[model samples]
Target: MKRIVPLFFWLFAGSVAAQSPNKSSWAPSDNSTIVRIHRVEQVKLEMPFPDGSSFKNLKLDEVMAAYHIPGLSIAIISNYKIIFSKGYGVVTPGSSRPVTPTTLFQAASVSKPITAMASMALVDKHVLMLDEDVNHFLTTWKVPSNTFTEQHPVTLRELISHRAGVNVHGFAGYNRNQSLPTLIQILDGVKPANNPPIRVTAVPGEQESYSGGGIVIEQLLLTDVTHKPFSAIMDDLVLHKLGMINSTFTQPLASQWRSKAASGTNSNGKAVPNQWFVYPEQGPAGLWTTATDLARFAIGLARACNGTPRAILSQPLAKAMVTPFNDGGAQCFHLDPINKGLFSHNGQNEGFESLLVMNWKTGNGLVLLANSDNGEYLWDILLQGVSKEFGWNYHFDQKPKEWLLMAQIVGVDAMLKYFNTQKATGLSENEAGEGDLNQMGYFYLSDGEVSKALSIFKDMVQLYPTSANAYDSLGEAYMAAGEMGAAKESYSKSLALNPQNDNAREKILQLERK
Candidate 1:
């Protein structure tokens, strides 16, 4: 991985580690496109789908009401500084408690990136070794020796990268009245912990797999090594250093902070019994933070990547943290390739949802928190709006729904003819990509529009004749359309193209038996 040089070292660079930007000064600048767009409540932006329709101006208030989100908080960072921070709606469904800029929400899996950052700090201080076998450092309950471990002992690096083959993709938090399990009990999947035991399911360093269970191991390692609580260690190592004063990894947040905490709500806007789900799995899904605080953490990381003096991680370690460990998986942060040097992660625990993104190169980022399970429905709109307002190079795409509208307007046959002609003329801007078209076909199938789906899959197979997946999808579409002979033919072609296509092989067997 390449080291990120400080931003000020470049030709156009002016200064480094200067004072944070003034938000009031950013108001409606007449000369700036970003300023003009920022003034609007919502801005229309293009989605990823080539054939998808662009959404018109969407209002935040309308979206919140439509989605039943009780509250939302947002912060935008520009040029290694916070440019804007605001809150919307209420802390609870029927409460008069308006969510303020300081109100905290559950950070959920966003906690993983923070945990990884703290671990990197440990690496810098020689307190933790990334490539060292984690079992050697763990003083608490040990990971059981299994067949997988005999071949390859799991390392801290692999654990953070999610290539350790750890089981348990995520955790669903316990209800307010439910008995909370100890960290060991959670790892062992005994009693109160709802999920199965965290164990290696494949050879370490095999492939990319998301595992919250792996992060929990890091949490344990941090506590055991430091002889202090995870929250306290993080505070000293990363949180306090980054000036994220409104954030903490403490599970079951203390009573004094309750008034500033946003209550979680379901899709229908009903509040959770205890206002929020309790996440004892601290490394993966336990952090209470405001968007402003998270933005501070992001800015600190950007400054660190740029080699600013007094920054948290050194340039080498920061680069490695964002570097993809196995395949395309970043150690903890999720990589967004659309924009250059982007690292992001999203989180969901019960009714609360959160996302944090930062473009390290540009020192631009955004943080969003919503107190509703259905908040995801508004993510695209909200992100695109912010991107447009700030002129950030973020890509937000949707599955092509223009095909459905086109089928309604020019008829499916006409659309098919147009798509089929792409063989010689080449794919146009409006033509669907393999994944997008495949998903669109499946959406139609799920919606019981069998004829429309068959048309789509037929086009897909025609366009991508050698694709095993395309044929498999076509076969599924055929089966749904009740054309068993056609389905069998498609499946056979799929199996021939890729013998490892278990889905096609199974479908063929079922058809043969019938």
Candidate 2:
């Protein structure tokens, strides 16, 4: 949360005039300029209008400015082609550079799908097999023998589908001036690598745990098997073949393309430290691309599924790639059942974010990229807008109703007072849980509003007195506020309520020692 904009106020701002300087030169893709322009104003979240209407028309500039998002690029595809492509907001605050359809953004975890696609190229050539043990292909560093992996070897299929039970959820990436590690160093979690060692934590094929670490191993496998650089291989196998001409998997980005890059921004509407993060782990989180370019990739894949000659994959292989290993996990790409067979993927870097979605049958899709931490939330809103305009029959998640309603009718403070008086009458565990207030407290804590956080935590404990989590959260607020005595008291209460709360017990010991 930024001090300049309150969360509730920013989320529910009234319509402001379109402030986008780039709006005047609107350039939608060929054949659908008018419809696409209208779609921009149809921006509505899942929530109904204040007066109970189904949707509300919102201006792109107003929403972007409200959320402090510096830049956004969007592309809509239909019938195996891009129907619209446009940009909103500036590349950086107070800069003359405006975001364009071609503005490159860090693709983040969305790189996984592209990497998977390239790996499929190897499979097609009979150089690799999906079901074979990945360790057999590794030449530099191998997956260490462990109790969990002894039962079943980690396979390429399991790794790509996130069923390999590997560790390391993602990478925070290294800053520009920091020493960069080799691929082997990152896998071994040796010096200069920020994340822990990539290792099997659970029985392979038993469960799915998303691991960028697993993807890194696949990256290493591709390089070892092909005897080629990861970026060069991906460019040849996927990017060039799919006509993703403006995309690259190169780390730190090339110097010639630097001028076309969008500057990364933090949640506070400020530039990220050192501008952007350098991702050496290319398989999971390294890509520089535009929304339009991603749209082309999506369209090409959808066309391939329909047995189009331009598809990089055969019809059967394309179908298998999008199919889930189990009901819970997508193999190479994510599938959304509610959106009528949409294959979707979203990614987030330190300050950049992107989303790609396409219905293989309809050949309709959306690609969105933004240069801010808040881009994730903004993308949800944009999805709702596109769904409504195109009649895509997709569902959008609703905003927190009770919180919004209470915040509007009664003040934010009134909800706390009402909770204190009403007990379980108005609030349900699902609606206004201790976790909700706990998260709100941390939001303020991250913004350096310790007093506000303290008040929120107090209200949480007052409402959910029996919950150990509530008292534990209150103790953390007290500790953050530098009130050692109160923190100790809250921790003691938490420990008394739940002896399983080792965290609270340790905190009490730490406070007494201090």
Candidate 3:
């Protein structure tokens, strides 16, 4: 493990943090391509014009700072092998502990894919059937049957693909000091469980509705059938088998990996209280892993998909894992339409965000793990760089909304100018919306630019007068700027516009108290 100087000093000094030691024989002979990817900072606006001037290249460190990301790690898989992996920035804002390739970050919903893979492995072993009723395998608890499940039973296939119509889209992990819920409590959504009960709400296998609660049911199924803990089952079925040594499904994380774990940070770059949330919902949200390890998992899946002998999954099962169900989901991964072979999954926990995109057929992909709420902000920019460097056709479209990019590079004034000019030309009809401006406002607020945030939000309110969210955002900006009277007024207007705006109502109460 290596330590680096604080983020401010390191960014100002333009120094490289110590690189993780490469033990893989597949390491690239020259890292010039990786260096070039790091230097890629240009943002190209997707304008109607044929020729658009590219924004100046911003360094990765500078981008990290602007986004208030404390730490990030990336791993690139090329030709069915991990060719490059590295980490950047300090683990926690002011800490000297540098993020390393092995540093663990919560996989969040990314855990779903791994859990899905484990389930598929069971299918391959004849221990579990994909189409079998999930309740058959579950001993601890069963999905409460209702009218929705009368015609179509909730099957493992449906659960894995999120077609089970289960309620609760995601889970909010418990605080470190909070009493943890058992698997049964989480499914039943009882005391100490912060979510509602997981139950089928629609006809199973009828439509796709992403439900982490559905995955928790599969977790219990695995535990019951295997007669082992979810974490142990994952270790034996997937992680250890794939040589993902740096990954674990254990909640609260193992003590041995504590020092090696990056502390989750909020969008404003502050460390999460107690460092990170404890996700007891292991199947849906509780995998702690490194980018390199995730890349290994991706590579292993790629091998299995290609019919490699003795791979973690059988050929048919592996192919089925990526095959989109009737509802357009492939087990846990989502297929990319642009590159038909690419399957990707993104994850977000309290203060962590992660993305895994891999083309199983071509064996090319990238894993990005960040200990910040705003981590996904860097994905498109970094993906562009990777696609350019590797000549990969399966990258995110390089074109970004003009105003949003302007907000990042030129600040509120330039962003508004471009936005207004485009609006005058009627070219901003689809691009410039209440949501875009609201996002821009929050970006400014998070960066501590109160006046800039206020400008954006005020304009947003003017643009969408009837939008309660716009007024609510304006109230937030006013509150951040210490204009309590204006904030109260804005919240009042928002609450008036939409009586269900509890956020605005709460803000009014707080302001009234003040």
Candidate 4:
């Protein structure tokens, strides 16, 4: 086991004060407007924190200054009532249009839950199976081949929940008329989704890994099972019924909605358009909807969690969707809960930033959608507000918990999107056994303890025997310790598992020449 890093927690209360150049330092006061809304009546509905505040008005404003986001929208609900729904700033950077309830925004991967709901609706009609193998209904590509010794089956649940292990974990190309490739092409990844054929490099269900590509397989599989295009199925189950009149699946950019939609920022802080809006992996994250529609969905989630799946699905399926099957990168509804098992997901693709969370027990929830990159402040502060409404407390010391728990903790960019269309809550729920061994290894490696890191890597390898990185890292650790034989053995194991592993190949060639 890797060394346990010490984490600090406070007794109660946490806050982030805004930093305004014009205003002198302001402290929490009796008359502070930073009060949270526990359950305000007559308001429209939103909040990310879902409870109280630390006087973060200044922090939120500073975020607007930092990211150059021109607009933001939010929705919140408690006990089936709309508490607050509103937008911030201008719709476009320079345009005069003010954001409103009707101002539509592209939700990106925030659209996953909607897709999940639509699929579950079909399941309600006996047209689909939640646990069926996607390969059974496919007319085109299927999950790639791997020499997995374990009999882990890839089911529909794996695709949506992100455990399908299909390695193409992301999308950046969704052009209109992009010559949609066959499902096989998308899976093989010979070209971008619909461009050429997508080749699969790993077997499905080998481990809990993210793959937007896996989602495509599930999407096409859904259509194949229903004998209808994915969009047609969505229109029937959700879009048409929820009155999501302003939403779409495939691209045309809806030039009218462009200005109202949020834009992404470069590392140096500049706006950029979404590259994937123009790829065929639209089902994974191509749908466009507003905070209102999403809030309606969130409310619907609350209803479903409370045994009200709009009569389209069972509460069991809805609960399964929110339950973490393989830690959806904490991207689309993963959990650590800090203690309890909770459901939450954050979607921040190229040009969009969004988040939604719900208490599995209380049925309270919130969704925040920003038209720019001001997600950090907008989301955290809003959640603080949400805490007030829910009478929950914010653990400030636990700030940045999700990132702290992942392999990549800096900026969130990875093609490896986690899927868990599975109904399982997790490997086992509790803050304990639910962390990334790779991440733990990195922390140990960073601390310069090679032996310690190797121990963690060994555990990880045993857990995910098919992962080349686990063996590769173990080999590196052996090499560092001057154990040439052990290093060669580990390297051989890695190469045997993944012949394409350049690092292992290079290490082996060096040993042979020596």
In candidate 1, which residue ranges exceed 4 Å CA deviation?
1-40, 43-56, 394-514
29-78, model 4: which lDDT tens digit per residue?
A: 43322254312211221112214421222244334534445556666655
Model 3 residue runs over 4 Å out of place are 1-27, 31-35, 41-55, 395-398, 401-410, 429-432, 446-449, 465-468, 479-514
lDDT at position 509, candidate 3: 93
Per-model TM-score, in order, reads 0.72, 0.84, 0.87, 0.62
Considering summed lDDT, which 10 consecutive residues are worst modelled in model 1?
9-18
Best by lDDT: 3
Worst-scoring 10-residue span by lDDT in model 3: 7-16
Look at candidate 1 and give me any clashing residue pairs.
48-397
Model 4 regions lying over 4 Å from their true place:
1-59, 149-153, 174-184, 192-203, 254-269, 273-276, 324-332, 336-341, 393-514
The Cα error of candidate 2 at residue 471, in Å, is 4.1
* Residues 433-461 of candidate 3: C-alpha lDDT, one tens digit per residue: 67568766776687688998899888878
The C-alpha lDDT values of all candidates are: 0.74, 0.75, 0.78, 0.55
Q: Residues 308-409, candidate 1: write the lDDT tens digits.
A: 888889988888877765466666677765676888877778888787888889988888788876555455555666676777866654422233333433
Q: What is the lDDT of candidate 2?
A: 0.75
What TM-score number comes out for model 4?
A: 0.62
Better of 3 and 4 by lDDT: 3
Worst 10 residues of 2 by lDDT: 7-16
Return whichever of 1 and 2 wins on lDDT.
Answer: 2
Q: Rank order by TM-score, top first? A: 3, 2, 1, 4
Which residue ranges in model 2 land beyond 4 Å of their true spot? 1-58, 396-439, 466-473, 491-510
List the RMSD of every prediction in angstroms: 9.1, 5.3, 6.5, 12.2
TM-score of model number 3: 0.87
